[model samples]
Target: MANAASGMAVHDDCKLKFLELKAKRTYRFIVFKIEEKQKQVIVEKLGEPTKSYEDFTASLPADECRYAVYDFDFVTEENCQKSRIFSLPGLPTLQE
Candidate 1:
């Protein structure tokens, strides 16, 4: 998501990515909340590092089969950027 990308943005990585939590497991995260109200994020890739935040629905798209459940430890965006999400052994190396 733009929030995730910009909030914890790396100077050279792609704005959006399908991250692998484990082998045969990939997921994506869009901005679910921001401050007082629900918001979505917008990133101007070519123009700036990232900018703009907007609103999004409170509900996730379970009907679309586009999501999965995983427990994540909430951390500041800065902390998230510096940490590795999963270990090397659990990384997605083979595309299935």
Candidate 2:
């Protein structure tokens, strides 16, 4: 969403892909970046379902800011299936 304060809006595809990831588990993770020239937030990358967390981390740029979401799934000790969605904003980069 665009706002007077930020002057940046999220792209439509960003929301659609996020919904697909959240509701359909179509992606393992998604990386988002702000396009200063476009003044918009857009998807930079989409991880495959078989990609690992390390892969997701590696996709981040060393000197840039980014937002990301990871769909983490695991089995509980009680043998219950569970899933958690992790949102990472302005993640600390290697430059930091």
Give me the candidate number with maximum lDDT.
2
- Weakest ten-residue segment in model 2 by summed lDDT: 87-96
Candidate number of the best TM-score:
2
Locate the minimum summed-lDDT window of 10 residues in model 1.
43-52
The CA lDDT at 33 in model 2 is 91
After TM-score superposition, what is the CA distance of residue 68 in candidate 1 from its true location, in Å? Answer: 5.7
Residues 1-96, model 1: lDDT tens digits: 233433532211222332332322333222221232333322212111122121112233334322212223346867763222332122122112
RMSD of each: 14.9, 5.8
Name the runs in model 2 displaced over 4 angstroms: 1-5, 90-96
lDDT of 1: 0.26
lDDT, model 1, position 29: 26
